[model samples]
Target: MDLDVAQVRAFVRTAEELHFGRAAGTLAISQQALSKRIARLEALLGTPLLLRGGTGVRLTEAGRRFLGPARRTVAAADAAVAAVSGADRPLHVDTWGHLYAPMRTLARVAGRAGELVSGHGRDLPSVAKALLNGDVDAAFGRVHPPLPAGLAHRLIRLEPVDAVLSADHPLAAEPALRPDRLSGGVLWAPGPLDRLDFLHRFAVRFGVRHTATSVNLGLGHFLAEVAREPDRFSLMPADVPLPRVPGLRSVPLTDPTPLYAWSLLWRSGDEHPGLKGLVTACAEEGGRSRWLEYDPARDWLPEPPASGPEPV
Candidate 1:
């Protein structure tokens, strides 16, 4: 027999309310429409489900038997919806290359095994929202306070930022970059949701001029745009390499600060066994991750271990 979901819903609601008029009101349909729906459901099932009696409605033996399967069908449908809604969009990792080093590595490993769909974002809120809404498989995000429930994360990189410039820019020839000299330029700011806004805040925190006009979430796009420009630049860690855009140079910042700490963010405790391996890969990559490195002795750190020092 052909089964329609709407018919199933109507049937369930009628069973719930027991009063046809109240059920109709609950479903926002006319009592007559509700009655017709019940008629259709009964006709399809080839059974008399309801008996009009004294002051209330009663379900026939067939109705009682069908209730279990009907509820199960609705539950199955809901589960299907949740899965589809969660899987329809590509999983968004809400951090730049520097922040999501471990997640990227794990994703690559998983990809080889044909087990994951991976992508990235450039900011925290976007990652958080996507994870909360089930749009991403995983992301690298900051350890923000009051984190939403059901997400698991581990530190992957703890690095200081440096100034990045075009080869032709004046600072490109400097011995080392400093925050004081990092301001007053068009910057490549990446945000998961609002790239420009996040950059402005970042600029303010570092006392750099936050007057950037162009920002983007896509690193590839940022590199392309910057390569074509003359005075545009932003502060990045020396270890976080950029795409080999011709004429682009990233220099070490002299008075570097702990500006970026990267982590892998995802729905925690998934039953998938592959996720455990992915999590292990991320935790092991911490501080020593290939994506960025840290030399603490020389005060040059990117994905460097917090305890060790490396000479510049």
Candidate 2:
């Protein structure tokens, strides 16, 4: 029986994510389409591959047995396509956490990294799924654990964070403010606190009790909102260029500054030539700019950086 590559691919992605919505997102297809593909693949094999329960999807014995070979098949198909299309295709890189302006860091290395095609992911999970699906060659973002298997990351930068508030706010005139100084004020965030791992961790750690959120329309809009409320404040990477939002003041956070970690994520065992160039360039730029310097006594990270040796 001739196996459809698309169906096999659907199964592989679904098996990796175990969530149809995310898997469908990685495939850039609708959930219905993903379901149809999985169903057809199961029918062709004449066996159930996945068990769907109230909790979530899980691999049946057949699926567990087929997963390894299915992954190989998908890789082979991708290899075949790359072979004919010329391997010099521009490396596609996805970025998330736009509030931090991750591209600013990427730009420092872009000149040395060669041809690149940039895309934006909604968040780290979506970017991770895209990396797993081979939809993008690499991604940049603030990666938090537990990172999914089959991926690798290298810490590229640790940016000091600043507390942004209205110039009219009482604390705005301070050159540097301790994190606790903002405890009584509302911590403004871009979305639901639970969904924003970094900000949520910061709030919980710093004793910021009251919290508020706004749609992440962009840096300008978000900062403008913060500028409007004297008692509202938000965190931003110190290096992000501030927009001309009136009444905006960015004060450095001192006495254990919160550092925003940035990392480069790619599929483990990827042999793309451009991937090597990008990694090397990041290392060079990071070293030159002192991007990875950290002092536990004076700096704070939500979690330790994932800068361990590359996984095999």
lDDT string, candidate 2, 125-157, tens digits:
989978878888899999998787667898889
What TM-score, over all chains together, does every model reach? Answer: 0.52, 0.85
Candidate 1 stretches with Cα past 4 Å from truth are: 1-104, 107-114, 120-123, 133-137, 142-146, 184-198, 215-221, 227-230, 237-241, 257-259, 287-312
Write down the worst ten-residue block by lDDT for model 1.
Answer: 303-312
State model 2's lDDT: 0.90
Deviation (Å) of 77 in candidate 2: 4.5
Q: What are the per-residue Cα lDDT tens digits for candidate 1 across 1-312?
A: 977766776676677668888777766888888778778989988888877778788888988887657655654564466565644333334454543243434554454332555556545665665554334556664554456544566655555666666888767888776666767666655543244333455566556654444454455666666656667776554455567778877676666443565556665433333444555555455434554454555443223443532110
List the global CA lDDT of all models.
0.58, 0.90
Clashes of each: 12, 0
